[model samples]
Target: MCGKGVNGFMKRIYMDHAATTPTDNEVVKAMEPYFTQKYGNPNSIHSFGQEARDAVEEARKKVAHLIGANPSEIIFTGGGTESDNFAIKGIAWANQKKGNHIITSKIEHHAVLHSCQFLEKHGFRVTYLPVDKYGLIDPDNVKKAITDQTILVTIMHANNEIGAIEPIKEIGKVVKEAGIYFHTDSVQTVGHIPIDVNDLGVDMLSMSGHKLYGPNGVGVLYLRKGTRIDSLIGGGSQEKNRRAGTENVAGIVGMGKAAELAEKRLVQGEEDKLIKLRDRLIKEITEKVDHVLLNGHPKKRLPGNVNLCFEFIEGESMLLNLDMEGVAASSGSACTSGSLEPSHVLLAIGLPPEIAHGSLRLTLGKDNTEEEVECVIDILPKIIEKLRALSPFKGSWEGLKK
Candidate 1:
């Protein structure tokens, strides 16, 4: 890891919070006892087991409190993808007799998208709604897409790649009115933004621990009481039989601690700091560079998110250049970063494939400083300039290359 040109300072600047955040020290300390001192199966009935069970239930309560959910409604899962799978497939399987139809947007995380696709192959019907230029799913469009057979409406709360916050509350009203169950894959928004399951009117929602500075391999599916859903992993009687697997005690404890910390941060208005940094990053980059498009809604985006697409150069080239400067960033969702294809979310939002290929995503976190952002703002323009100079896609702007 390094930063900037020869004379420039070299320091590792991590700006990829959407991918994952460093686990908070408090969260790690909370989990340490569970891993060593209190190791026991939560399903056991003995004292050790009861202690573990108590810890798990307490953690469940914390997670529920974070999102205004009842403790009994939280079903622990392996991660966000599994939580999403449980929400989509579990609901689809359980409610197959009610209807065979599902509604979701095209720009959803692959976890939701692929789950819906799998349902389609199994004699189910899915309506893949389109998004506008800002990656927003119109509530009116959702209303129009409903049918008598529509059983579920699964939309994302926020887009990971573009940081576009969907009209989830509005869509929730539409789904509730139609008597269809609603689910939101809120992996990108859960800990980063203020959320209330009741206010959102969602029957089910998905979130991952790692996305909120907790340990990986643990997540939650917040299923509103009485929402008919089947277990995705059926073996043990864990997660109130809604999900079956041995609980990850340490991870769950970490998640609970992380959730507590996140809630405190939100209540303290700490996210406003992220908003300032995010806005500064966006404002400086667009002002300093030319042929750049800021992706997602200008204001209705994640407080820590800044996604942009620079024209005339490949995103990979810019990423590599930035890496040499010791600034860690990404072009899109970390899940699909290895793929050679342009982001589907970018295309869904009306960006051409060439333009989409140049996208960059920078998500801020509590540890990030204004100075670090300033460093990125300083070196990024230089990287983009050098890349553009060597870019073969340069057209009328070729005369500026030197």
Candidate 2:
């Protein structure tokens, strides 16, 4: 039983790990000392400053180790959004002499899509490639999209909304054969899955701390050695002049600890446990519920992602009911939560607007237990039945069926 609601009858179960995760206790402990005891400017020339600088460098090594990259390749930034902006804009600006074209999938997070859109508004040309019904981008499509003018290929390693893991290695090989720079917005897959820059054949990768149970404002942009990219900011010579401004020392420390823990957990078989819970949740829900459509690739998905669209009911109404029952979930990305529009990812994958509007995403986490999954599975069907009973759309659909 997670947390009790106001009525004390329902337990608050958080199933929105994809949106953001609670900071691990060890991460908080790692960050606490940096906040007060080691509070010194890493750039300053003093003993205190050197201590902070050493901490930052150590954190960088940890982050690099997690991704199987050199410490020099990791550039700390404000967060995933900034890292994405840096990768897209930096590559474009620095490689204008090579080309002015970028390639990306239509179902990427807004960080990637909006960054590409921003470049499109400028002189650069961006090809928004289409995804299959499972939100998987074909490597053949990527090979076809390439041209002499294509400077960079930025695709996400995993889909945040639908949990479709892209064939990045295959795409990377295609891009590599063409001698084009490749980047991946791996904010969702960094800690959840094993990633090696060399194995993926990616030149740059973006990652967020919060997505992996670390501090919110810390992130890493893995820029491979000799990858030509301009700085997103212009001030101090931080992050090897790739990203400017004073570093978030405490946040970086927390992120490093989080990365270490994540790697350890993966080695100890955390993925298997999460996958079991995720599959159980999906199985129970689909078996008990009717008119439900599963999203994303069946097997090639994140370990804990369960995206489903219930017919004849609005997702927001379902979410509200779930919240009352003490279950926290998301219809889509938290970045686009307030928008009335259906999820772009769902729409891209061929879901009609009505079905897209009914999408529900339940992402499990490390702390989630089988009991929580059972509770959600037990109560969710009742909630859906209640919503369908009250929905005029469902009533009309039933009449049509009769």
Candidate 3:
């Protein structure tokens, strides 16, 4: 059993790792000194400041190592949203004379999607590519969408809601062959999957620290050498003048430690463990629940992701039921949870509105155990049954059975 909270509530089992992870103790420890003892602005000329600056550079190197990027290429930002904005808007603004068009999928995180929308409002044209039933954007569609005016193609490496891994390498190949910049919002993929910037042929990638067991308020944007991008924030010279702001020293340090730890775990076969647990959870749930469909690609998905849609129930109800039982998960992206609309990602993948409304995402993580998986499996079916009993679509399932 986990430790009780200050309110004497038993700790809930967290299955929402994709939404955001708790900062690892190791990463917190690595950042503690920066808060007080080593607290100095990296921009200052004093030795105290130089010590902080050195720590920031070391963190940058660690982040670069995890993604096979050079340290100089990594620009630290506020978080994934800021990184996405910088990658899209920064590139779009800098290259506006060359082209005023961009390409992206309908299933991207709000950060990228909203940035593209903002660009469209600014007189730039954007093509929102449609994904297939598996939430995959075809390379052929991407090829056809590229026009002379197309400056960039921004797609996410992984769908935050459905756990669908896009064919980024193939998409990158298309963009590279067309001589256009390819930017991927890799917030969900960076620490969870094997990512090498060169191997993927991506010109830019966005990553968030909180998504990978690091501190929030820190993110990294990997801009391939020679990529042209304007600075988002104009202030003190930091992040090579590409992202101008005072350095987030402690958050950057935590992110670097998190990246290093994730890299080491990847080498130690962490994927295999997560995959096994993920598969087991899916198998048990599917076996116990009727009229349920697994979303996303069966094989080509994140190792820790398991998204499903159960017939005849609303996702919010299921979530509330699960939460009452001390299990924590999410119906869709954490950013969009308060909205009444069904997940845009689920809709993009061709799920009917009713089915999309019933979606649930359960992402496993390093700290998750088999016992937790078993507990979820045991409790989930009962929750589903109760929800279905109260659902208006209950008749639909029965009618389908007949």
Model 3, span 1-402: residue lDDT tens: 432345778667999999899999999999999999999999899988999999999999999999999999999999999999999999999999999999999999989989999999999999999998888889999999999999999999988877888999999999999999999999999988889999999999999999999999999999999998898889877787787878989999999999999998899989999999999999999999999999998888889999999888888888888888788888853233677678888888888777887889999999999888988898899999988877756647555432
Question: lDDT ranking from best to worst?
Answer: 2, 3, 1
Measured against the true structure, the TM-scores of the candidates, in listed sequence, are: 0.95, 0.96, 0.95
lDDT of 2 by residue, 312-383 (tens): 888888888888878999895323377767888999999877778788999999999988999899889998
Residue-level error in angstroms, candidate 2, position 59? 0.7
User: Each prediction's Cα lDDT score?
Assistant: 0.90, 0.91, 0.90
Tens digit per residue, CA lDDT, model 1, 1-402: 225445566668899999999999999999999988899999898988989999999999999999999999988889999999999999999999998999999998989999999999999999999998999999999999999988999999999988989989999999999999999999999888999999999999999999999999999999999998888898877787777778999999888999999999998887899999999999999999989999999998999999999988778788888888788888853233677668889989998777788899999998999889999999999999898889877754455434
Ten-residue region with minimum lDDT total, candidate 3: 393-402
Clashing pairs in 2: none
With candidate 2 superimposed using the best TM-score fit, by how many Å does residue 142's alpha carbon deviate from the native? 0.3
Model 2 lowest lDDT segment of ten: 393-402
| Model 3 residue pairs with clashes | none
Better of 2 and 3 by TM-score: 2
Clashes per candidate (backbone, < 3 Å): 3, 0, 0
